[model samples]
Target: MRAEFFIKSFCRIENGQVMFNGNTIFTTESEIFSNFSKETYRHFEISYPKFFKMDNLSKLAFLAAEIILKNENLDADKNNIALVFSNRASSLDTDRKHQKSIENSGSIFPSPAVFVYTLPNICLGEISIRHRLYSENSFFIFEKFNAEHLQLYAHNLLRTKKAEKVLCGWVEFDGDDYKAFLYLVEKNAEIPHTVQKIESLYYNE
Candidate 1:
């Protein structure tokens, strides 16, 4: 059977606020990733200690994923769910940090912790590990948000039965400016997975 995809739920994090399905559930006055992310994590009551250790890029993605998947009741065989994520910044935010750690220091020491997240896909791995999902994952870089590319790729994954559901969208963190718009796509739901619809949700200020 040809599968039809729908958005099960969506979450957006920007302007120091976290919104899920059009409702703002959390907010902070601090914009710094260190303070804002920690405050947001505490507000959500997330117990993941590793969240503190992650780079800004991963923390932004991880917190958004937490809100998107909060109410989901997944079974052991979650390999059917895939993560399809894209961002314009790639890993530049972390890459800068890693570079500074070596270049600014007299001893020229690079922290392995910061270096690990130099790849944009590392956030996907963090989400997969947290949820224990062993499914396909892909990360794409674009000059800006490409709704058509995301919609087409996610729909194809479902249509081909490569993934029963997909968590897809944009998660970008460069410097202190950060935004994440993530949605859970499934076989059937109220919101059809159309390019226009995804773009609307993404650009929905």
Candidate 2:
């Protein structure tokens, strides 16, 4: 029989609030995605100087990963954790910025800093880089959150010994709207990793 897996830790960062494992650990009144993310970073005292340079999608994903992994004592050489993240917009927010920079007739050229984040999977790289997790990782774009797909992907990774633990969820930032929901999956944890539970956690049920 395949060993069961559980959601060891989860994080939700959206609507100007940050929740860890179903508890509101930090709250901000600012509705602007940039301001809220920066404030939350400062409030949490996350020690990453490069965080300020990341695009909004990366910022949201980074914050969610930071909240859950701070207590994890992450190994610099850890290669057992896998990352599977999905988003609806596929870096449209940053793509727009890149476009604007390119279309600016007054400017000579587009900003290279902003141009680097045109791909949605770049956020996954950001999280992986920060956590030092050199494991199998993939980023998918869906019309909406596909909980069933996520459950299946994580399960396969865990069962096949590709990863001892998996970090999976949705992180999206499109224009001024943004949201993030991340969970860590492993054996012998509190909540079973299932489609129903994933939908409930995402929908706040």
Candidate 3:
């Protein structure tokens, strides 16, 4: 039998608020990472101290994942869950910061803490560590949001038994511009996982 997938829950973080399932959970005047991310983190009562050390990209992805997976039973068959994420800017937000640190005359040393999150996949690692998920994961870079690509890959992962559930979306952070639209996909839910549906949910927000 072919596998059927449905969207379990979705969250969108943009326009100075974090919207989950069509309701705003967090709002702030500051949309920049330094101020907005911290506010949202505190609003959610997240105790992860390491959150401060993460770069903007990781912070955005982590917070979005936290909201979606908050009430999920992640420990049960954790390896059966997959994380598939995409972004247009890759890690340029942090990459530029790392570059400036290296090029600065006062500080010529590259910080390992900052260097660690230079890859876009680092966010996936952060989420995996938090949920103890040792499953298939991938990060893609696209010119823009590509729902077709996301739908195809996620559905293939589930249909091929690579994963039972998939956490997928676009998390892009470049300077003051950032957005995270993440959703959970599972077998047989009310929201069918379709290309048009994903695109609609993403752009309509």
TM-score for all predictions? 0.94, 0.95, 0.94
Clashes of each: 0, 0, 0
Report the lDDT tens digits of candidate 1 across residue range 114-171: 8899999999999998888888899999999998998889888888988888999999
Comparing 1 and 3 on TM-score, the stronger one = 1
- Candidate 2 per-residue lDDT, tens place, 112-190, comes to 8998998999988998888888889999999999999999999999899999999999998887788899999998788
Misplaced by over 4 Å in model 2 are 1-3, 105-109
The most accurate candidate by lDDT is 2
| Superposed model 1: Cα runs more than 4 Å off | 1-3, 106-109
Compared to the true structure, candidate 1 yields what TM-score? 0.94
**Model 2 / residue 8 / CA error / Å:** 0.7
* Pairs clashing within candidate 3: none
| Whole-model lDDT per candidate | 0.89, 0.90, 0.89
Q: 1-205 in candidate 3: lDDT tens per residue?
A: 4437899899999878999987888899994568999999999999999889888899999999999998785665555789999999999998998898888735655688888888999999998887788889999999999999989999899889998889999999998899999999988778888888899899863
The Cα error of candidate 2 at residue 108, in Å, is 9.4
Provide the global lDDT of candidate 2 against the true structure: 0.90
